[model samples]
Target: MRLEPDVILANRLADAAGEVIRPYFRQLTSVEAKPDRSPVTAADTAAEEVMRRILKQDRPADGVIGEELGFERLGAGRIWVLDPIDGTRAFIAGRPIFGTLIALVVDGQPVLGVIDQPISGERWIGQIGSWPSTTLNGRRVQVRPCRALAEAHLATTSPMLFSRSGHAAFARIARASRDTILGGDCHNYAMLASGQLDLVMEEGLKVHDWAALVPVVAGAGGVMTDWRGQPLRLGAMGAVLAAGDARVHAEALERI
Candidate 1:
């Protein structure tokens, strides 16, 4: 139907988060560790706070699942998933590759997604509906085709995130692909959607991590799913894969 309002609100949320995060980029001096030992800076918490406040005022009936902050309105059916900074390590290292991920999931399916890199002033928006497409800064983009997995360029945030068994599984895909690059968190998916990269496979992602990626990748003519080749949903496993070409995706799945 008409998703214009939601889309506008999503953009507003990204804009607000970016404003909050920009000030702390390279100036951030302190960081705290979560039980998982992941870094959380004031920037992350502040960015999520601003987005959450805006959502509460603009779409109070909707739910929110944020990385820095916890869940809100879990049963609201229409949820906004937020990852203030998908690449905290990259962000802490003064890298501009980190992104703020915002997603609109309705009934467990992600219908809208935005990957915004404030430092680079780049945004990728994707929507699924009667007409499905992805745009980067208002320009439509599509994934490039790859004839075979041997010719595909692969990327993953890091192999360290995977368990022993998972690492072995990903090693198979890495060996089969043309080349594999490390350290790109959510940016790799954005690159895949924009035809810069071919595939991104990683493990140990949460719902907020992969939810927004589904629409962004799919709308750009790519396929994003769990390691088993199943469509990603609300509660899917953390192991995720995104491939620009379905043929390459299928081939990678077989290897995984």
Candidate 2:
């Protein structure tokens, strides 16, 4: 099926952002540390600017919250959330796992999402009231049904964000799962939506990091929640778990 209108627009912006990011992936002349100590590159700021311009042109009534430009409150019911380059570190390292993230949040709930992985030529999109799917070079895809934790595949972006207890919790969860993949950033969430991955749990995320993913996972017949099984909210950093099935999410969260 063709993508919904909002999703189609998001995909367009994602592709634009991807185009801006591609040339800078491995060609960065320098990297600077932000006040928060996280690294930023020219690619990050440039891609975000491209996306923001597209959004502002097409959806003037909608507000936007972006990693680079901060937030603009349009006071509209719909807001676009953007992470121009989700895995900048991986991109700078010349890895193929980085991507652009975009989502439309209405009434504080994410209703549409798109993740574009340029190197992989993959695009995953989801909208509320529809099943989430991936378009790999433009082909439909769905999440896998891994019903139990013992047979599930797991992934986390980083283990360092977790405290000693958090790390132990992650280790325990990893031991319970059948397999684990690490370090894919937002790409991992796309993998989950495509059924290639089963679960991803992590802590320490911004709205830009998690918002775009919520609709993608949930719309695909999966679940995305905080550790306590609550729906995720923007502007807060906490535990996040994305699972292919609800039962697997419950089981995995128990271990964490």
- Highest TM-score, which number? 1
lDDT score for candidate 2 against the true structure: 0.83
Screening candidate 2 with a backbone cut-off below 3 angstroms (N, C-alpha, C), the clashing residue pairs are 132-219, 144-195
**Tens-place lDDT digits, model 2, residues 115-156:** 888877788777666664545556666778887999999998
Question: Which lDDT values do the candidates have, in the order given?
Answer: 0.92, 0.83
Q: Write the per-residue lDDT of candidate 1 for residues 7-114, one digit (tens) a residue.
A: 899899999999999999899889899999999999999999999999999998999999988998888889999999999999999999999999999998999999
User: lDDT: which candidate is best?
Assistant: 1
Tell me the deviation in Å of residue 140 in model 1: 0.2
Looking at model 1, report the run of 10 residues with the lowest lDDT sum. 125-134
Residue 163's lDDT in candidate 2: 74
Regions of model 1 farther than 4 Å from truth: 130-132
